[model samples]
Each structure stands twice: as C-alpha cells, then as structure tokens.
Target: MNRSFPPLFLFLLLIGCARNSEPTTVATETADDDWWKESIVYQIYPRSFQDTDGDGIGDLNGIIERLDYIESLGVTAVWLNPIYSSPNDDNGYDISDYRNIMTDFGTMADFDRMLAGMHERDIKLIMDVVVNHSSDEHEWFVQSKSSRDNPYRDYYHWWPAEKGDPPYRYSLFDAEGNAWKYDSTTDAYYLHYFSQKQPDLNWSNPKLRQEVYDIMTFWAEKGVDGFRLDAFQFAAKDTTYPEFPGLTDTTFIDYYAMQDGLHDYLREMNEQIFSKYGVMSVAEGAGRNFEDAHALVDADRQELNMAYAFDGVDVPKYGGYALTTMKEVFSRWDAEFAEDGWLSIFLSNHDQARMVSRWGNDSPEFRAPSTKLLNTFLLSMRGTPYAYYGDEIGMTNIDFDEIEDYQDIAARNGYTKARAQGKDMEQFMRELNFLSRDNGRTPMQWTEGPQAGFTTGTPWLPVNDNHAQINVAAQEDDPNSILNHFRQMTRLRQDHPVLVHGSYELLLPDHEELYAYTREWEGVRMLVVMNFSDEGVTVDLPELENAEVVIDNYESLSRTGSSADLNPWQAVILSL
Candidate 1:
C-alpha cells in the first residue's frame, strides 16, 4: 500500500473524526457576533497558485481544483489577490475594468463557479479592491486623456503640462523624481505615485467615487464576503498639490497616503456601500501614523473593519524582526485597539518576502520547525491572522541570478534606478533576492514532476529548484509535515477562544531568542512560547497549578518544574 494512501479503515476513521470535530459552537460568546474576528484568512496570489489548460498561468479553474486543499487547511476565508481585468502592469493591481475578470484568469462564469465552490465548502471569499489607481489602459483613463475637457478628465489627477511638472511632488515609486507623466494627447500630466502606467484615481470626483461604490456593490451583491482595499491610503490625496518646503530629495513616500480627507472618504464609502451591503472591508494603511491606523478601523468611525500595519513587514531588520520590536509593535496595536478597533495580523503577503525566509530559519534542517514557530505566533495572536499562500508549507525565497529573471515592475524599476544611481548592481541584486515581491510570486510547488506539477507547460515564473524535495505531495503524506503542522495550528486557533479574543500580555519581551506571550480571556489563560533562534533556550515559565501542554511543534515537552528547556525553533502552547 502507498504511504500517501491511508488504509480504508484509517481513512474512514479520519473522516469520522473530521465530521465530529466540525465547529458547532463559538469559542467565546463575543465571537458569535462577527465571524471574521475569529476566522483565519488565507491570501492567494492567483497568478502563482496553480495552472490549468497548459496556459502556464494560474487561473480560476486551477483554484477551483485546489479548493479541497485550501479547505483542508481549515482557513475560513480566502483573500484572493486582485483578479480584476488588468494589463498585468502591477500583477493585477492596475485594474483595466471593474466588472470584468482578467482574460488570463478566466471569464465571469469561471469566477462564479469558483465562488460557488468556496461557498459550498463553508468558506468566505474576499476580493481585492484596487480603487487607489487604475491601469492607464482603462477606458476611463483613455477618455480622461483624450482631451482636457473630456468630462472624464476629472476621473484622475491632471495638471497642465504648461505649468512645468506641477510643482514637484513625491512618489513612493517612480524614482525619477516626478510623480506626473506627460500625456501628449491631453497635453497634461496625470499623477501616478506608482509606475506611470498606473494613474492615481481622483477620489475628489463625486462621479468617480460613485462608480467605485457601484463596483463594490456589484461584487458584494454577487456574494463576495469582503474586500481588501489595495493601497487604500492613496485613495484620497492632497488636491492642493503643494510643493515641499526647500526639499532636496524628491522621493515621494510620505506625502501621498493618509491625506486629511481620507477618513471622510472612508466614512462616505462605508455609508454608501459597505454598510449598505453589510460586508467587511480591510484597507492597506501605508504611511499611516499609529493614530490613523486606529482611526481607520475604529468601530465608531464607520470606515473599514480592519487595516494592515506595516511595522512588521516594513521593519528595517535584514533578518527577522527584533523581539523587542515585535513585542512593541503588537503590544502597542493591542493597546490601541483594545476597546474598539480591529487589525489584520500578518507577517507576509503577496508583496512581501516569505516570512520563514525573512523571520525564521529557512535552511533544510530548521525550515519546518521555524515555520511552525512563526505560524504559532501568528495564529495565537489577538487579532485575526492572515496566512499567505505557500507560507504554510514553508516556502522560501527564490534567488534569481539575472534581473530579467524577475517579473515585478517594482523590482525592475528599482534595479534600473539603482544602476543609474551608480549603486553596485551585484549588491542591489543581492537585496532583491531577499526583498523582492517576486520572491513570493513563484509558482506553487505541488509535486516532484516537471514544473512542480503547477503546469504542463512553462510557468510564468520559474518554480524553485528545491521544489522536488519541498513540494506538497511529499509533505501531505508525512503526519509531522509543515503542512500538517499548519493544519493543526489552524484548527487550534479555531477551537480556542483565548487565541482569538483574549487579552495579550508580552512575557520576557527582552529575551533575545524567545518570543513569549500570554493570552487570557474569561478566566482562561494560555501561554505561547516560541524560540526564534536555532539554539536551545531555557526559560522560567510562570507557575500555574494544573498547567498542561496543549500543543507543541515537537511531540515531547522538556520541563523541569517552572523552568523549561526548549529545543531549537521549538514552539509550545500551555493551557493554564
């Protein structure tokens, strides 16, 4: 008998267990109110998830084919990265049409089939909402650029080309020092904080805002559970277009997002669309202060349900985040949102490097254990946890040798700008190996076959060379595989109320190798201990009578009274 195929009796037994273990009651009374607060969100980058029809690109059918795999991981919500019709300038972030599906992904019928498949599995689907900008190829932008008085000209930020570059504003992208791109057709420059191909939408336009609301309503009515607003802070900008005071460096990072009118716009959005449909919405809160992060999700403000804070992903540490910084960031957010606000807790996403590579050891020996440690921390946290695609199986960053091996616009643009700045191209390439968004965009490894079983033809991006050893098929058979560990950890989160709604308290915050924290709720307390390093550590755990080891990466727990010796990259959860 094949090890991958369990005995008939064992298979029947496992099925019985699964049916019996289905969640029939909330972990806590409060959890019954909002399903999202207690649910785990799995993010899928459609272009890399799977491929069908030998198209070399992941499509809706591929996702549908793998729906059982996703459902088996116990993720209640799937947050798909942008799948709207696009020119692929920013990997679907630049939407060309609001209602149509990308031809590369599939058609509306395929999308409907995928949606129905997810609903059948009792899973919710969250669509990406990229309203901050649209592809320059979008019909709206094409009309806006036709003439100064084309009526649609107000749909995007436009200034007279005669005014000589419109007073020099900053752009987070476009290292060329000009956020405005000259269009000869209209003879004016449109503002684009990112690549010139992605024109920032003019949120001040009432008609444009109405159109966005209509787009959102269309999806909401179509049964999408929620929307993850992309680059949402940039949706509202300072219309005044004031120049910086005596600024020498014109990098446009700080001035674009979190403008004064953003909150009003969010409230208006909620009032018009989100509130009406009664759907959850999260935003990408880049460039926001702590206050703004809280304000965006404060229940009274009537904006988004949650927003992602970049302190973890944006941390300057070349390796993993410092323990102090992790404790500080999470604790601060916990304190800020303890009363009213909500936050989406995640360490990696489509635009970030794999967390196991960035924060944990990704070597052959430590990858699985370290990945478990990271997942334990994420799922056991106070806020809703988001697991990025491929991270659950301990996917590591891919190191491409040449710039042409990369497909991301940001990576290519950064390389070009860095070379122009006389930076060492080799060193820049090294940084890209670690930080490039392309690191997370590689094809998902499904098996040891050609193309890692992702496609029958060439893949959009090269599959990692280690795919043969690290693919899902091999791990699915191992009970102790990282994939199984993720499944177990995900189930633990869904079953334990303390992991979701408990008050968080940092333990041993200054410990160099140990990340220790406690979550308490309704007379229940659980301690989560993780060793972030590859070296063993001894920590004095709190004395709790009748404490039991509820979950652990390794099967064994070495405890000497109140002091416990942890193995390399070991993680444990103690019920007290």
Candidate 2:
C-alpha cells in the first residue's frame, strides 16, 4: 500500500458540480454514421500489458491470452501500441521493418491470432502506425546513406555537406536537442525530429508516401480495424528549411506541426488506403488550433476519423495547471466539433504520465474515489474515450528517486541534457519524477504476488510498488472498488446513446471546486456532477421531475431539490 503521488501537478483545481440554463458551449448530434463514434478504445502498451514468454516483455500471444480481460472491461476496441520489428531504440517507435513484428513481441502469426481473438470477443483492433520516422538501422535508411547517388536517397531528408549546415530544427528526444545528424559516409546531414537513431521519413517524396500507403494496406488486409498514427502531424515538413528567429524561446510544435501540404497527404492516404478498407484513423497529435483539428477529421475532409488533440494532456506540467484552463480547453474543443468531425477524449496515454497522479488526488485516503471520478469524466465525455490499460485500477506514478530507474529515452536523454547545461540535478529529477513517461509505462498489476503477476521473469519496466493495494484481483470482487466503478461506467456508456451523440453543456464553468455538465439527446437528458476536492461541497443541481440515479461512484446520493450536497470526490449520473 505504498501510495505516494507526485507533486501536485494537474487537476490542482479539477472541483463541485452545478448546471446553467443557457449553454456556454455548442451542442449538436455528432454521430455521423460511423462505428468508431460509439467505441470505447482501450489502449494497451504492449511492452507493459502481459508476458507469456519468460522474456520479461509483453507480446502478441500474451494479448491473445488476456482477450477476456479486455472484453470484461466492456471496451469495444483495443488500440495496441507498436509491436512492429524494431531495434528497441525508442521501445518500438523507431521501426526497422514495417511488415514484421518485433522479436520480443513475437511473430506475424502471433499477431494474426491475437487479432482474431479480439474479433472473436467482439473487440476491434487498432494498430499503432509509426510512419513518421524509421530506425536508422532500417533497410531503407541503411541503403540511403550507402552513397549520395543511391536510388533510396530521397526516402529521407538530407542536406549535403557541400551546402552549409542545415537550418536549425528541434528534436523531441535527442540529448543535444539537435534535429540534424551528420553521416560520415554520405557527408550529409539527415533530419530527425526524435532520437538520432530515428531518421525522419520524407513524406514529400511520392515514392516514399506510396510505400507507406502499401504498408498500411498490408495491415488493413490482415483485418486490423483502425490505425493510430504516431507523431504524424510532423510527417509533412517544410523542406525549404527556413530559419526562425526565436526558435528555442517558442514552443517547437508551432513551427513543426500542421505544415503546408499535410492535408493533401492525409486526403491521399485516406483515398488510397483508409477509404478502400474502411478502417478508422486517428493521429497522435492534433495541430495548434481548432481549424487544424477540424481539417484533419471533418466528415467532408476525407482524412481521419478522430482528432486526438493533446491540449488536455499537455496542460499539466511543472508545478500545476489552472482548473479553469482544463475546463476551458475541453469545453472549447467540444464547441468546435459539436456539429461535425470527432475527438478522442482521454487524460493519459502511453506517452503521458498516470491519470490520477497527474490529474486527480492520488493520496491513499482519496485515491479510489478520485480515480473513479476521473474515469467517470472520461467515460461520459462527448467523444470516443481512450482508456490507457492501468488507469482503470488507479495506478499512480512510480516517482523513481534516481535517473537510473528510468528507461524511456526521453527521460534519460533529458537528464544528460540538463546536466550538460549545468542545471540543478535535484530540481531536474523532481520534475522528471512527476512528468516522465515511465510513470505510465509500469507493468499492469494483476495480483499481489511478486512482479504483480505480470511475468515470472523481471518486468521490462519495474512494476509499481503500490500494486499490492491497487490491483485487478484485489478490486475484482469489491462492488465499490475503482475497478468496478470503471466497469459500471463503461457499461452505462455502451448501453446509452445519449453519452455518445448527446449535446454536451458545461455547468458552472467558473466554479473553483465543482465540475458539472449535462448530456442531452433525443428524449433523454442526464446530469453529471463531480466533486474534485478533498472537502464536502454543495452545488445547486437542475430541477427535473422523476429523477433516478443512473450510476454514481459513491454508495449514496445526498441532496434536496436544487441544492445537492456532495461528499469529497463523489461523482454521480442522474437521468431526468
């Protein structure tokens, strides 16, 4: 029961529930005749989910074995992270072979069987697509750098040494923060928005683009139902390599994301691959604004199925974020897409930290209730919700004290960069403890025994120490457990269309401690009231006759007509 959370970061203020007469955000029927609209996408980080072999890494056969567990959660679809062949540079993000599976994760036959097992259980499979870059060890990259005149040279961006140093660009995972890495053999600098081992693919090349489309078709033909494009917003770059004055001072995504010609590529991608197979599509990062998001997913755009914006996920950093900003960001996005297009609602994912630690109270006293409240929000939101594997059981951050415990390339390289710059090592470790992706990458906790029953061998990443108190087996039979609350919420969502196609209206948008909203569609209207604080609070609820409770995190509801009393961390759904 070691329940230590990170420094108060997100949901610092995320409080009480109340509703208004007039809607502050737009509301419309957004179901556009698509299967993905109603899907509860459960994201499984393959390396951390389960391991059948004694290799300490989760694999496709492991997923096949656990198909029943996924089905039990009532999730309609599973968004499996990359299992593609890789050198493990970025833990499978840097792909060496787009067509084969990583040796640690198993073979193509295992993947096919896993996909079939999911389909048998009525669960669709969404494969993670990492075409933004390829491993430097990939055949294409190896051949491209063999000689300057090689036919594969155009597959990647290159600036000959004869031309002066390549224009400055930023790398998200590089230790030196340099995007250009020089090759001695070709005497040229190649572009990489991530680690030096991962070279950015040239989407500008028609040949390269077609090759990507063909690889996608290969998976589609194998019966994969969806694709989550990884770091794809930066796929189409401004090859002109223009210089910026305040590059380091400004956020890098502004210059690197949603570049020119991106729409054309997406449209072409859908027409050639997505449209033909009728598979759902979503990119990892949305653009800087709403217009960019809409262009990527609007029904008329013929591009993608959902806009997986990062505004909600990126708002939490450093010390804390304003509760008002969290509400505004979600409300504004809902307003923008109320009429058309779609959004993926989520608070954490493979690349982010844990949900409750970052966005809710993770202390021992309030962990279960607060985690349930957070899942209630995610499940009842106005879009298709993506649930990371461990979030359902209230997994908090591991908060490793030293850098050696960190395995993610970002954390390791970031530490190197911080030390090189003479920054305070203690301060850097504190922030890393709170924000490192490893916080979300811990192995799934299934039991109270050694290694949380994740593997007989040591886990690829250490299992969270608090697994004894917070695990699937411990909470499986408790009706009041966070795990059960999550199950009930997902079942309610799947049983009710109002949660999917309803018009969402934010209630008491400015309240400091209350978050209240209502979802109404057709002839049904339901109110969602959540108390996101540690003290009991009161909020005036709407007056509706014959109100019956649909679902609630707490054991009982307290209230009289308009004035409803809420216990700390209580969440409720009522039908009117």
Task: Please list the residue runs of candidate 2 whose C-alpha ends up more than 4 Å from where it truly belongs after superposition.
Answer: 1-33, 544-546
lDDT of each: 0.80, 0.85
Give me the overall lDDT of model 2: 0.85
Candidate 1 to truth, TM:
0.93
Writing each residue's lDDT as its tens digit, candidate 2 over 1-576 gives 012334322211212122223443334443334889999999999999999897789888888888888999999999999898999989999999999999999998899899889999999999999988999999999999999899899999999999998888888788888889999998999999889999999999999999999999999999999999998888998888899534441376677888898999999999998889989999976776777777899989999999888776655556666666667778777777777788999998877789998877899998899999999999998889999998999998896998889998988998998899899999889888988889999999999999998899989899988999989999999999998899999999988988888888888888877788888887788998888788899888654234788888888888777677899888999997
TM-score of each: 0.93, 0.95
